[model samples]
Target chain A: MEDFSIIKQQDEILREIEERQPMFTPVQDFSSLEVEYASNPPFQAKIPYLQSKYSGFRRTRGDGNCFYRSFIFSLFEQLIQNKSHLSNPDSPYSQIYSAIKQKVLDSGDILNAAGFLPICYEDFIDMISAKLEMIPTTEISQLEDDFKDKIIADTYVMYTRFIVSAFLRLHADEYSGFVEGYPDIVSFCNSEVDPMNRECEQLQIIAMTEAFQIKAEIEYMDRNDRTETTLMSFPFEYTGPDFKIHMLYRPGHYDILYPNRS
Target chain B: MATRTRLLRELKGKTEEFSLNNVGDDLMIWQAIIQGPSDSPYADGKFTIEFRVPENYPFAPPKARFITRIFHPNVHFDTGDICLDVLKSDWSPAWSLEALCRAIVALLSAPNADSPLNCDAGNMIRAGDMRAYNSMARMYTIEFAQERNLN
Candidate 1:
């Protein structure tokens, strides 16, 4: 009887641990996204907005980290597309690495000037920046290896999350001035933006787009609205490049979307 | 994976207040000594924490525990295990080792007894027994943490 009770208690503890784990991994592979759009007609109607902008999108996990994962995936693929546009067929991965290296450095510079403590994220950024430079292979073949390894791909996602977190923390006064209910910076960061696995909302979206200087469009498909999808661009009023990433936000989740130019 | 890089940076960035080094070339196992804040009951205390990083680091949080006994609400007194939210589900890849050490110091200064691992310490705080809690914490620091300061 005693043994049975102890085993039952152990099962309960295991179940709780499993529940605490994320429903999905940091990143997942791409799949045909049309099936997803086709299933929801209301959502399908909004695809034209995306169709005018993007080619296709890769699906990320439903986990809260999807925003970070999907954002990095789109950022790199965009660089790859531009690099490959020359028809050189030579691997664009080297250029992609350089582009990422540049972006992180740029963000780091901005954060540093804003009085953000680099020590908080110095190693996190360095490791990611080093990954691009340290691969030892300036060749495209090495990028193929990077793609196959799940940890490498996920590392990019982790780095992106760090970038956003640092930006939001450093520039709290500039951004959080309008935000309601946070008495101070740490509380605001801790509750709304800093911690891992907290689903990002408007504040995070703005901070990331402004910090990275990447224009982005987030289209919302609501459970209540059957006819129209709300398509709004980020950073409230940043008028920059006409072309940028288009993301599909369906209540609690985000995914990349592309134009079907073909 | 990036733990060593951050540790080195932390060392350079903060010349004092922290002493972090790997036990060996393993890089995965590190010993950290955090200087308690001057204003706290644990002031002048040098607390030792062991950081155990997993193979898939940056993706996972290091398991940090005090090797020195600490009479605090968030720290498990006997095992020295901490109940910091950031060390668990709240961990983000953005946090560096230096950030963690600073957080540990902050934890020592202002412990959150609301959700504590050390029931006795938590209860004392909740019961508004500040005088007793301070004396007890100071005693632990004197016994376990002050020796490093003296040295």
Candidate 2:
């Protein structure tokens, strides 16, 4: 009788393990994730190892709370599609990434995509909860969970918005003129002010403008008219109180747009 | 499907001169030419740029660089290192190649003297002396772009 019960218990445990194994399986090939990411350009270059790990997660498990694995896979795909355009060390993407990184002090979403956030968040929550022994308040416990959730939500939203805006802005000039019934490229240029955070407002404007440029580019490309190439040589320029941008574009194996005079 | 669709959109919307090239099964590269902004030192200049996107894009920022040498305080003289905030920690998934190109154009018009990748050039700009800055910039542009007839 005892032996039978032990066997039964073991079988139950095995079944449970089998059921949960898929969720725990690590992500393997991030290359498979290139599709969504390719749709939008990434904010930074990914490390290969990190990319592989993130891809593996997406392959095995669907979506974790952080969705970091999914994000990584998408970003990798975008990089692959745009690799030729990014060959130049001074390309616009590189410059913008450098510029944004320098300005933004904290970007949790980026950290998460790099595969550092999920585990960190878990550990952080664990540590804080452990401190409950000292203060032992139900309110505190509830507050901690709420705070963590808010942070996660904010991070995810901010990251997504930034990526979308950046993509649109980068291609605005190329696609703007071609978008039928779309707002004129010049009309899209407007100052945005944020009362909550002045710097955030500025960043948002920059992002919006960048998105506009990308939209314009995409619209132009869609026309498929040979005449579209005629506009290829037009330079994109930006004038802000703090900075002035003068960019040049050319055609070849890769799109070449560089700062200064290229 | 999403990636292909987006690429198609970008390609169709792009001016005919811009083309996307596949580097590997998982990498795609793009090439484009930009005209110099009017009234700037780079005016009438034709510049080329390259963008490299990895498979794990959007999460990781794409790598970009200038194919031709450029003269600017914010850009590295020898390495073409650019001082831009978005490429680093601030990178958001929303940024695209076109937006980046515009930013580069903007950077040329407004060189960031506050954060100088090229110390000498930055100093000249900060010193409030346009003479030295403009001269060196013009000389560098001529050497890299005009002499080579990149435009």
Candidate 3:
């Protein structure tokens, strides 16, 4: 009875928030964030440093799916914006896109090996592959519109979550040591990575980046009094190509960040 | 499109243990008939469950409740609502309608008395009265979960 009522309350609150906000808001300047934190001195102090590095950011709804949602949207936006290079077979962007697309398709084996039925995840794989195939020919606005469609956006996020869960489950020995409260990696993935609206933590982020073979940089922009926000790369010691996805992380939420051109 | 495909696939995978069907030709509403586990007191019974697929299918768990009443600790006696973690917080995109029905069948044999939706069933189990609990559960199984009742 207590559990039932608590879930009901959560649903009501989530519905109210959903009505007031879109899943993905258009990109906004750093100054807008400054205005939002005017009353908080620590956050205000950190804004100038953020503004110095990042030109702007797109705000994803603060729903627990923010991290994965931001990552997928930002990654697609990067591909869409550079579609000219992506379309040219000779370009490095085109090569990278080909490699990533193949890997995304190949991830189905991982999902299957982890004991998930094809019917359960094949549609998700199809959805992701179709979107990836559209990247070289589609416009950024089209991508934005797709993300605005809740069903489309959630399917992408859900697939991303499954890949991460699959990676962790298959490589349990490597991750079981890091699982804190849960008995093992499988249960940890079940509780944290598998559920919709469950917040993403550091372990899941590591698993997602590794599984997709995509480099990502997350800038920590919290309310703490830090002179500069910390830019942390997944695969912490990554010395490979530049990160393709950049996100601003503030406590429990994440938003896409666009770095200023040098 | 994905939901319909997945449900149609499930409809084709029906077995003697469980069978799935669209309620009134509506894909969003489904009904399943589960054969009781052999080792449990519900051995001779068959249970019917109603599943309401949410808009975000697979990502969100389908809403499931027993349409055939039974005596169980984790299932509400009056409302038939079940209180399983997988149906709530632990659901994954990897799980399908077939998987969920299998879990419900598993739950029938292993009832968690700690968080009971049916107080009578929970109290009987807590009091360590196996004779009383088994008979009551079997009696209800015979009364409401007969194969004819489901049909």
Candidate 4:
């Protein structure tokens, strides 16, 4: 009675929904929710509102169950796909950046309480790529315009977080005691260390200079295959730490020689 | 019928009845026994493989594992996880089951060492030590797949 035009618009949207039914036919099966609820009576007791909302409101239990399951399933699917993308070597760095952006958007109370940002594996690659570009190479000027500062900054922070997290997960037995002790290593390292500065690069060079330091540590800690060595070893122009930088070596693959440390 | 379904039917008629006993609704797990391709390290071998289809179906790619062990850079030793992209992110829903089976058979012959599932195998292959890789392949074939009976 109030607005005939608004009612017509609503009807148009409803018609669109009806037209799209065939496209969504696979997801239309919600009858199983009723059977699931009947089998598991405790679920109704725990979430009485769910039962009330569906059954009391004259909506089928199957509809509620299907909707919930589909939502949960899609969420998990996205997580796995994102994780796989991160682990994939061939995936472009931008994919990881977008994933990080999505994580920032999706983050809420649970992630905030955990005190960590959700970053996919590709984010790690993006971080490494950024730091690698900043090593003041003779070839630095030749780098593509796409490889610039903010990307480098974001990547560096994300990479450090990934490394610290991986180190913690891998060496939980050796480092679990230190978990409570060093609650904010990634944040502290990122803020205080300044990886962009010459000092941090020197520190990284020193750590890497020992033959098999990164390799042995990563192998022992991560338990992942050594295949990543080639990908991990790029970036480290000598910061005057009594070490000879070897070219023609793979990125993640390196054999560090530390004459000073020895 | 879908191209995949049709292709699957054709392959089933041509090949021996190969199926896995244990599988869930989410996973369309199958055990395949493939005859080795000619002029390959895996020639004259009958290799076994396992396929796992995810619940997300066409969106997320399925996972494939070698049930019968083989010495290859693209496959793990203890676990049979393959390192090929076709099975991973590069997978397309357009890929047919027959094509996947053929690819698996082909992978037995040629392995990409640049991206290796087994570092030792990759190292050996990269070093051009084909003898070592072949011997290892032969050994695994004998140990895991009863290659002696095939010959």
Candidate 5:
């Protein structure tokens, strides 16, 4: 296989995804996954176990961006669930939101340092700030409604995608060792990390979670993944606090998981 | 907010390449001008551009098009729709309108025919007919975008 380089330019990328994918598809409730998992055998062995653990999991469009999209919605869900705890300075949700806002602002600096097109990063920051400013009026239950508004959800997800891409490229030297056989860290990020529809790998995941510091846990649910150690924590250095999030990972995809002890 | 602040920054930092055409204080809908790059077909041309910002300003790229009609592989002849990546999906708020104007002027000198919004001009260049393309492009620039039209 040839080495990975930045694939199609922007116009081509937009056209490819335009025919089949919507910018943001509304996240339906979790009941739908229960139905699909019950019928599909490949996912059968894990259904009973998964159903016992998660109340519902929304499936992002399998456009190779399932990971980031799932992460945003899952974080949103957690934010709403813990909204009343806002006054607590240690609130995990509040911390993540503020961190996100800072990341949006800092993205400008990163883009400028790297000498990328200014308008591209500038416009994304604008969209990101608009959503961050809407927090006071955004109710917890209406979180799904916000997600339903394609514009609102797309804006937030685009913000996350942009930050993750910029973070990897800007700090290329620091994360270079993570991906082997790439031309260089900058090129690796341009092709792998920056572009939309590119799937997230271990290195990308680590950089993203660490940059934002939103502690995360992944419970693997694959055919070969049935051991007590299936679930794992990111950052590999977690003495500060346990993860506020619990996600179920199935090879290429990830979704939120809520344990149903009841 | 980002777009509004950015327009003000551009207004304050006006350069010789492009100047804001509107003084009405409507930041959302802006008019601007760019002098065609030297030694290019568009040289001596004064092109007007319309900058339209959506309510979602920086989130979505501000839509920009040439109000001046000219012949170029990267720019559409009739609508003056420019085929610039920064103006499209690659657009991020990191850019100010001033930067966009500079890039547009740069596009005047170097037209990438690989992906053409104006196939006629694009095909002429793609066929490796630089002599024909330059003359035709010059024709459009002189006829539609000239010094006489400058405000």
Candidate 6:
């Protein structure tokens, strides 16, 4: 009980910190990371290489759902920036948005198959669809402000987690072998994939990229022997030239990355 | 607001083993009655559980406590807190109170002795004293959770 009380106190402190900090901070220069990691040689060594390829980054709250938050926020930001070409049905942005919208609408079937009752997930899915609908019409600043609303942001993360879990469940035969500790795919999804604030892993990343039909690249900044941060792309076979979302991963946290100036 | 709406919808869904009702029209605080699993020592018992839904319902799990005393490895004898993963770290927004009721009913039958809130009950199961464990649990159910006693 004493241990439990200590944990509860720590959680209160973390929650207080979370309230003071923005859910997603505005774009910050790569030099910010350099200063933050100055004492750590391995991280400092990779900053130059990272800077060469990426201009700036948007910091996400260190909550466990950072990966999903960063990915969705970055994707929506891109779509909003391309709003000029939205009227042109032939434009790549328009095509991508249309395809994603359809996927969101069709996700009900996946959730149903995963044993989720429609009554439970309908509100979450509606919030996700409403936000997606706002992208073309809404300004970038509005998108950031909307995400700052904890309920709205958490609702999106929850739905996205469901999508990831459902995808893994549907393709259990393919992923069951890769799952390490859990007895089977269902239990793995129950504990690891569906829970709020659970960190995402490689399997979840693959599942998200595949289920949403979005390409992503992660710049892994680690304390390894390598001087440069490794760039790993999801959906392994996709050697595509364009990735819809780019993220910087340092240890447990993830943040959105912006491309270098042309 | 969403929590209230979801609870209203869940009130309509039917389940034989458990039923949940609001406490004096308070949507956030619910009262649930769970029938013991037929094969378990707790059979014929009707356990009362109090569920306190946090403001962020579905996102955060509702706090469930066994109001009626029961001898089990996972439920606290004094505080009534049940040591269940779904109520804590494993919670998903996809789960409804109805689902939680079902999970609770399942937990009564398969109490995890490894992570016990009631050490005495847990030790009994761990020591392979099935006869003593069953009888003690059965005695508690009759004393505190029997249908007549619950009323």
Which prediction has the highest DockQ against the true structure?
Answer: 3
* Candidate 1 regions with alpha-carbon error over 4 angstroms: A1-56, A84-103, A114-150, A169-171, A178-181, A190-192, B1-14, B36-38, B148-151
| Of 3 and 5, the candidate ranking higher by DockQ | 3
Better of 1 and 3 by lDDT: 3
2 versus 6: better lDDT goes to: 6
- Which runs in model 6 stand beyond 4 Å of their true positions? A1-13, A16-20, A239-243, B13-17
lDDT (C-alpha, whole model) for all candidates: 0.67, 0.43, 0.85, 0.42, 0.68, 0.86
**Candidate 5 structure quality by residue, lDDT tens digits, A59-143:** 5555666677667766666665666655566876566677667776777887667666554555567765775656656675576
Most accurate candidate by lDDT: 6
Interface RMSD of each: 7.4, 21.7, 1.5, 22.1, 8.2, 2.5
Task: Tell me, per candidate, how large a share of the native contacts it keeps.
Answer: 0.46, 0.03, 0.72, 0.00, 0.15, 0.69
- Candidate scoring better on DockQ of 5 and 6: 6
- lDDT for each residue of candidate 4 in A1-262, tens digit (9 for 90 to 100): 1133454575476456445432112222224434644654443232232322222111111211122122212222232334434444455333433443444333332222333333223333543444333322313222222222323323333333333333333334543444233455443333322221112222232222221121211111122333221222312332221212221111122111111122
TM-score of every model versus the real structure: 0.75, 0.38, 0.94, 0.33, 0.69, 0.94
Candidate 3 — which pairs collide?
none
The sequence of per-residue lDDT tens digits that candidate 2 reaches over residues A12-92 is 764564466342223244353345336533311232323322223222222121122222222222233334444454665
Q: Specify the CAPRI tier of model 6.
A: medium
- Report the lDDT of model 3 for residue A21: 75
Error of 4 at A127 (Å): 42
lDDT of 5 at A176: 74
Q: What is candidate 6's local distance difference test score?
A: 0.86
| Model 2 TM-score, 2 decimals | 0.38
Q: How would you order the candidates by DockQ, starting with the best?
A: 3, 6, 1, 5, 2, 4
Two-chain DockQ for model 1: 0.36
TM-score of chain A of 6: 0.93
- Which of the two candidates, 2 or 6, achieves a greater TM-score against the reference? 6
Q: What is every candidate's C-alpha DockQ against the true complex, given to 2 decimals?
A: 0.36, 0.02, 0.70, 0.01, 0.13, 0.61
